[model samples]
Target: MLEIFPVYITPFEQERLIRVYLPKNYNKENKRYPVLYMHDGQNVFRDNDAIGGKSLELENYLDEIGLEVIVVGIDQNSEDRKNEYCPWVSGEYSKKILGYTSSEGGKGTEYIDFIVNELKPFIDNKYLTLKDRTAMAGISLGGLISTFAACRYPHIFTRVAAVSSAFYRNQEELEKLLKSSDLSSIEDFYLDCGTKEASGEALISKEFVASNNSIYEILREKISNVKFEIINDAEHNYFFFRERFPKILSFLVSAK
Candidate 1:
C-alpha cells in the first residue's frame, strides 16, 4: 500500500510531500524490512500525480513482485530542482549542454543533510525497518545526488542505483571525489545510461554515454561490487526508467 503525507524539510525550511510504500503483508507479519529512499517523489509512484503525467509506477512493480520493503519518495521543489540536485555549480560541460551559462547548483549538500540527518531518523523511528539495510535510487539529476550521498555517507547507504544520470553536470568534481573517497562501505551499486539520452530521438549522443562511462570506470576501481550498463534505445524519461526499474531494483535488493 502507498501513503502520502506532507512533511517539513528542516534544511530547506519548506514542507514537501513524502510518499511511503509499505509491503502488502506489512500488517500481517512482524517482519522488519529494508528501506529504499528515492528522489522525485511525484514520479516514483502513481502517474496521475507525476510530472508530464508519467512515472515509474514503482508501487505496482513492488506489489506485483511481493517485495517487502519500505520506500520513501522525497518530493522535489521544481523551482530549486537544479540547485538541490547538483553538489556543485554547473560545470563547463553542463553549461554547454544547455547552450548557455547557468549558475543553478551548490545546494545539494543541504538537501542530502536533511535526508541523512533528519529524514532517515524519522523513518526509522516510525516504521519497522532494518536500519542497517538502507539504499537509495534516482534518475537524471536525481541520480547525481544519490551518487553524491553514497560517497559523502558511505556507511549510511549500503546500496545505490543511478539510472540515466546527468553526471555531466558535476562530472569533473564528482570524478575527482570518487577517486579519493572510501567506497568500501557500499555493498552494491547499479549505474546505467541510455544511448539516446541527449535528445531522446533517433540520434545517439556518444558524448552523453562517454560521460557516464568515465564515472563507471572510476567506480569499478573504488567499489568492489559495482555494475554498469549502456541500455540500448533508452531515453531520459520516466517511460524508459520504468522499463529498467526492475533490473535496478533487483540488483539493489538481491544482496540485502
Candidate 2:
C-alpha cells in the first residue's frame, strides 16, 4: 500500500510530500520492518507524478516481489535541489562540465540533519519500524547526497545504494571525508555507474564511471560488504535505474 502525506522539514522551513510504501501485510500483521529512505520522492513511485513522465515505478516492483520493507520517499525541492543534495558548492570543473555559469550547493549538511534529527524520529514513532535497520538510496545528485549521508551518519543508514551517482563536483572532498569518517557501522553498500552515463560522449561517460569507481574503492576499504558494478549500456535516467533496482535491492537484502 502507498501513503502520501506532508511533513514539515525544519531545515528548509517548509512541508514537502513524503511518499510511504508499506508492505502488503503491514496492516494485516504486526511485524516491524526495515525502512528505506529514498530521495526524489515524486520520481520514486508512480510515473504520472514524475517530473519527466518517468519514475522508478518502485511501488509495483516491491509489491510484485512481496518485499516486506517500508519505503519513505522524500520529495526534492526542484529549485534548491543542487544546493540541498551537495555538501559543498559546485567546483569550477563541475560548472564547466554541466555548463552552468553560477554556483549552487552547500546546504546538504542541513538537509541530512533534518532527516536524521527530525524526520526519521517522526517516522519511527508513527510506524512500526525496525529503527536500527535503516537504509538509504538515491539516483544522480540524489545518490550523491545518500553517499554523503552514509558517511556522515553511518549508524543510521547501515545499507546504502548509490546508482548513477554524479560525484564530479565533490569527488575529492567526498573521498577525503569518507576516508576520515568511521564507516565501521555500515553493513552493506551498493555503488554503480553506467558505461554510458552521458550520451555520445565516450570520454565524458568514461570519466563519470571512473569517478564513481574512485568512491567505490574508498568504500571497499572501509565497508566489509560492498558491491560495485559497472552497468553495461546503461544511461543516467529512471529507466536504467529502474532496471537495476532489483539487483541493488537483492544485494542489500542478501549481503551479510
Candidate 3:
C-alpha cells in the first residue's frame, strides 16, 4: 500500500504532496529503502490534479512492478515557479515570458533550503528512510531546480535525475560553477532530453539546442558518474516522462 502525506511548507504557505510507495514485501523489520524527492508533485503520481489525466502514472507502475521506495512530490506554485526554478535569470525572459517581478528572485535557493533542511528532516523523522542515500528528480523547470540543488549542495543530494532541463541562462552559470568546484566525490547524475517538436516549447526550438548541448558537454567533462540520453522522437510532456520514469527509477535505485 502507498501512503500520501500533504505537507505545508512554511516559507511559501504551499501544500505539497508526498507519495510513499512501499514494496509488496516491505518489512519494517528487514530493510530500509532509498528516497527520491521529485519536483512538480501534482504531475508525478496521477492525472487527477493538474495534468488533466495526463499524469506520469509513476506510482501505479512502480507499485505494480514492486520497486519499493519513498517518493516525495513537491508541487510548485505556478505563479512563482519560474523564480523558484531558475537559479539565475538573464535578459527579459523572467519578466516578459515567465511573468516574474525583478525583486522576487533568488527563491530557488530558499526552495532548496526548505527541501534539504526542513522537509527532509520532517520526512526522515516520520518515515523509514535511508537518510544518507537520497536523490532529487524533476522535469523541465523542476529539472533545472534539481540540478541546481545537486550542484550547490553536492553533499546533501547524492543523486540527481534531470529530464529535459531548462538550462536557459542558468545553464552557462551552472557550467562555470561545476568547472570551478571540486566534483570528484559527487554522486550519480542523469540527464535526458527529447528531440520531438512537442517535447517542450524550448526544446523544439533550434536556439535552445545549443544550451542543452553545452550543459550536457560540461557535465560529461566534470561529473564522473553521469548518464546523458537524448530521445530521438520524444517531446517534453508528462506522457514522455511517464515512459521514462521506470528507466530513471531503475538507475537511481540500483545505486542503493
Q: Give per-model TM-scores.
A: 0.96, 0.96, 0.86
Tens digit per residue, CA lDDT, model 1, 1-256: 9989888988888999999999999999998989999999999989999999999998998899988789999998999999999999988887656668888899999999999998899999989999999999999998899999999999989899988899989988998889989999999999999888975544336677888899899988988899999988787877888998987888888753
Model 3 score (lDDT): 0.74
Q: Tens-digit lDDT track for model 2 on 1-256?
A: 8999999988788999999999888999988998999999999989998989999898999899988789999999999999999999887657656767447889999999999999899999999999999999989998899999998999999999998999887776788899899999999999999999997888889889988999999999999988888989898888888887987877765524
Q: State, as a TM-score between 0 and 1, how close model 1 is to the true structure.
A: 0.96
Which stretches in model 1 have alpha-carbon errors above 4 Å? 200-204
Error of 1 at 167 (Å): 0.5
Off by over 4 Å in 3: 27-29, 91-105, 197-204
Q: What is the Cα root-mean-square deviation between model 1 and the actual structure?
A: 1.4
Clashing pairs in 1: none
Candidate 3: C-alpha RMSD to true structure equals 3.1
What TM-score does candidate 2 reach?
0.96
Candidates 1 and 3 compared by lDDT, better number: 1
Which residue runs of candidate 2 sit more than 4 Å off their true CA positions? 92-96, 99-102
Query: Root-mean-square deviation of each candidate, in angstroms?
Result: 1.4, 1.4, 3.1
